[model samples]
Target: MPSIWSPESDTHITAQYSQKTLDQKVRNKSALQKECGWPVEAKRAMVCLPLGMTEALGGQVFRSMLPGLFTQSMELLILGKGSKEYGTLFTELQKEHGHRIAILPASEASVHKILAASDIALFLANVESSPEVRACLSYGVIPVAPECDTLENYDPVQERGTGFLYAPAKNPEQTAWSAFAALARALETFKFPFDWKTIQRQCMESTK
Candidate 1:
């Protein structure tokens, strides 16, 4: 069991096991990616981890973001071995969005390599600070997680220009729509005359 840490203010939810080990893991994985010469210089918004440890967290939330993200030429890399529950859905999504989406399980080296190739790491789950978020920061990949009370202290995403924050939805059907809108907001922030590289450097520098 992995343990996920949240802000002390949100004591209502108990710590989960899987995401607790994410921070250090991100650091290590990012280092490995650098050592292996994987590049993390792209400006694409890539939503990942559904096929692996992050599966089932977002439910149907991610499905709605495909159209928007793909239109922007952003690549969504869903790594890890997907659970049986989502196998069919994943397959269908892959077929429909394979032009910009990758649905498959990969090795650690491969995972790091993929991370190195990403820019924004999207989170559709209720996670305030997931290991994937920490990992993204380590690789200079900005994190875009849901906005909620539990993450009141997580400033990176909440603060303007550092990252994007979308409100989380309670209804399962609304989850996808909320996530898509949030991601759209995030895309707007990353687009245009905005200096993405400079923002990336700033974000990396601000990380502890």
Candidate 2:
């Protein structure tokens, strides 16, 4: 059985969340760190993602991002119970990057906390933006995602510095490569001349 039930292929279950609710739920940064067991002030960038088998968000594309993630020393906080296939991959990743990878099941408090503590939140598939995007913006976490035609409302990476965007391609390999490149670029933003705080403020502005 899937973690979430969906009647339609593109259904966004629990994707509706008010900014006020997000703010209230994730108000205390210290509490968020405690709940998620992530260092609120870690030097390494923390990336949180909510993905599932139903979304076709796991497999090769996901595996491709691992190398880049490990190279950057980015701590990944994954939300969603893994399907059997992803579970095996997660086990392999954990063996190599035990200190950097955390696989977490979906829980309201933990989800909000993880997003609040993350420096970036990721969405790989072309489906509608997850509600976590808004939650991440509310907490000033930049979103790293692929640009898809089906996306409605605002684009987080509309400009150069607001957030990171990768060109979505027809070929899965190309798409994965693009996403990996974007992930690398996102990690680079934390280094040198770039004003991370200003970029984060811009991410919040894009959400409006």
Best-fitting candidate, scored by lDDT: 2
lDDT tens digits by residue: candidate 1, 37-132: 444433445555522433467756665555555666455666646566666666677777655566545665455555554556777776554565
- TM-score per prediction, in order, is 0.63, 0.70
Residues 1-208 of candidate 2: C-alpha lDDT, one tens digit per residue: 2222211121222232232333332334334444456565444677777554333763667776565666676778777565787777776776667666777666765564565556777777764455655556655667777774322222335533545778877776777788888777777776632366666656555565
lDDT of 1 at 117: 48
> What residue pairs clash in candidate 2, if any at all?
none
Please give the lDDT score at residue 103 for candidate 2: 70
Candidate 1: where is the Cα deviation over 4 Å? 1-45, 50-55, 64-72, 148-161
- Candidate 1 residue pairs in backbone clash: 2-17, 2-18, 3-17, 3-20, 51-80
* lDDT of candidate model 1 versus the reference: 0.51
Error of 1 at 114 (Å): 1.9
